[model samples]
Target: MQEKRDPLLNITTASSIEWGPCDPSVITNPALSCSFFEIPLDYHDPSIGYGRLALAKLNATQDRLGTVFLNPGGPGGSGLDTLNMLADILSSLSGGFYDIFSWDPRGVGSLTTPGEIFCFDSPDEYNVFWNGTVELTGIEMTGNFSDPNDVHALLAQAPIMQAKYDELARRCLRHSSGKFLRYVGTAATARDIVALADALDGPGSLVNYVGTSYGSLLGMWLINMFPERVGRVIIDGIVDPTLLATQETATAFHELADADKTYEGFLTGCALAGPQGCPIASAEGQTAADIDATIQALLKQAHDAARRNTSAPVTSEIIRDELLSVIESLGQAALFANTTWPMLVAGVQAEAGPESLTARRSTRSARRRTRRSSVSQQNQTRSYSNEAILCGDSIDLRRTRMSEVFGTVIAASRNTSEMFSVVWPAEFYACPFWPVRAVERYQGPFNKTLANKVMVVSNTFDPVTPLPEAEAVAALLGDNARLVRQDAFGHTSVSEPSQCLNAVMFAYFVNGTLPEDNSTVCEVDTDFEIFPGVNTEAILAAMVPRKIK
Candidate 1:
């Protein structure tokens, strides 16, 4: 017989637990001391109630309730960090009605929960993981593997690493009394939001929730799971979960291509505006091709340099870092587009100092040098995270000859998405070779048949989740769902400019209001108001202005 379910326990919400002195660590560093809070790892476990999650809270004067959880949507990202960055923007936009609070999930950041299989012990180790492993033969680099077997073989002593992770996870789960490792999906996390609310108070407890990217998916899941429980949900950079599962390849490939387009736009925009005129433009025209070639050439140079510098039997692992940086740089549309302005400003500012030009040149030169090795390392780490979450949460792969099956798909699809087909290949090329499949598989309809309050926002030219995948997600939600089309070119529309779409989101979450139609199309940023700002430049200057005469 199954164990009897305990009757729900009634707990009183505490008013202002003194909040302890704001941790200077979070504030001084901006990176560290943000907000601090703790959650019992095993809310139900009585024997070892030791696990606590350190958190940070960011809010404007308009904040009413104690806090609101801010999720930035990285299964691996630090929520605390997300809130720190968005606090000002959110406050100004929302008129400061709620405090934004975020915590490192069970396995991440300062939470210290358990089940930490990540081998991020030292900078060198982290660098290695970030750069990933490659199968480079002779002087020229060749193929790379995302497969678990290949990775395991490469990290021959990885058993020790694996054991460390397994032990931590076991301890955390055991202490937390959480047996739902299989249920740690978005749905479960949504339910946890309810538990958090209950622990705080009912109904009007939290001010509102603001999420971006994966955060939006979590919001959707939460709203679906408990409609009446939600107060205000601001989901930016929205992702369609349903499409994410079923249309992984189709979505990913298209997004990658879209990324190339966005890069082209950035390059074009920079060229037209000129380096000194536009925040992003480099010293000269610094065309897009120049940037791309600069990055790629850096890799070759780094590899050659390393070869010459090291005759003491250098490993592919060492050279892979520069390569990983190159590959990852290709997908940095969001960063590249944003960085130009910042980098240009920084570069100009650096030019004023005696060592300014030298520093700037040195920095770029260093980046160019490491471009090759870094790419390999980044891919390795990313591949690990991808496998951990994707494979761990996905259904069991019963297909025999996984590699051949995926290889066939790649071959057939080469006509369309050639790069992806070549890079990702198929099941044969997958990481997490022996992933622990979810005990309960995700069925065709990614979500439960709840009323279609699901609001999906997809960019027309997203470089990650393609437009088609967004449509597929909306379709999966069926008649009850809605698809908000952001006529922008990027991943996750909410984060991009589109005040009209944002206003729609505010109305829906604030008052349970939905558009009359199931689909709403928003033009690009130039066509709409940028939220949280009537004048972004002035606001930015006021908030973090440069010292001037």
Candidate 2:
């Protein structure tokens, strides 16, 4: 009998993309198209199975320069969703001369895809996993814990937290098939991009691409893996692959410092805005320093109230979490500042009466619960796949003790702001108990110079990926890459309001022009609204220069 062939292993490439109308609900534009492309789950072992990636494309309005691939970060962010939302603006940014493409990376998108990374048996079960015993039984998973006694109290809960992580790992194994878990690492995903590039632009052609945030990691891996295939690539909001490749507990703390810097930026910005501009600022002609003191006092009061188990409307933990959240939304800080500043003011201004506090707490709790439910529904597999990818990519955390990890992080946080310290390190706690790893992880010689020089963008005050990491990535890529530093505050420079950065990117992607200065520093529009609403026209207009300088 003849040996049977794996049908999915057929690797012939010839423009397999078939574009058609996207769902009107997803994208209102009639100009865009959507399609699904089949790729192997494990590129090295094609016999394992095949997976389909959902992709969205917008044709160039003018003569096509080439295809530009985009990834919006979130080792789990839906590229298709991002492309649908930003297609028009991105097209204009490219000078209307390139077809833009984005997709849902393997292990993400709809569960209908073959070998999707399923962790829970059902959505309801996933919700319980998020909001139940594990969350409620801890010493309130996050807080500044500046007090030594408070730090010790959190430390004491390590055993309980460890048990919860082990249980979660076991549940993931019980609920999800093990075959696909080994195939979702950044390296394996990079292979899928290679295959897609071959299918779309012919085998081994240079790839025209733009990657942001976690997406920048994808770009780095792509160039290192296939240097000759690199085209005019721009990696914005760089994540240091070197740190990611390590197992050090201190690495997490260093990451937290990025957020801490952005938090300080928020306070400074508020002070500069003044009492009339910043809701949190006292109207008594208080300086930024005075306002900072007042906020700290309110936080201390909330912390004391929570320790007493009083019926306060908000707790120190809640305030800490909200502050961290606002920092994360620094891309839209102006709008978030408008909302969160008022809430902080309200919390500080509330009376000490139990009935009054209880009523306000009840209303806030209801709204938060509703918002959490909606977010959980939308992000059904985000947490699962994020853990899966991190665990699958890094040094196994199973060998490390949770107590040691938490202790190191807590100690490190003392040197900086402890506000975001507790929550940031908590993410890696489950890594020690993760169930699987990729079969062929890419341990890199990232220092290799590429066939084509690439462009990198970074913000001086990014809340997530910091400036130093972007510099490190550029250095690692040797002299082949240029780093553009945007003097701004946000996680990613692309989406944030910056005409100079946009002009730089447009010149590179459209005209193949590199900045004259290797390490160029660009300034943001001072008067630009960080929290500009969803008016795409206004955004595009802002990007387009009325007169070329």
- In angstroms, give how far residue 361 of model 1 lies from its true place: 18
Best by lDDT: 2
Residues 175-271, candidate 1, lDDT per residue (tens digit)? Answer: 3323434333444355446555654445335335666655766666666555555555555554566544544333334434444444344344444
Model 2 lDDT vs. the true structure?
Answer: 0.66
Candidate 2 colliding pairs: 397-432, 398-432
Q: Highest TM-score: which candidate?
A: 2
Cα shift from native, residue 243, model 1 (Å): 5.3
Lowest lDDT sum, 10 consecutive residues, model 2, at 366-375
> In model 1, what is the error at residue 184, expressed in angstroms?
5.8
CA lDDT of 113 in candidate 2? 55
Per the 3 Å backbone cut-off, how many clashing residue pairs does candidate 1 have? 47
What TM-score quantifies how close candidate 1 is to the native fold?
0.60
Residue-level error in angstroms, candidate 1, position 530: 15
For model 1, the local distance difference test gives 0.43
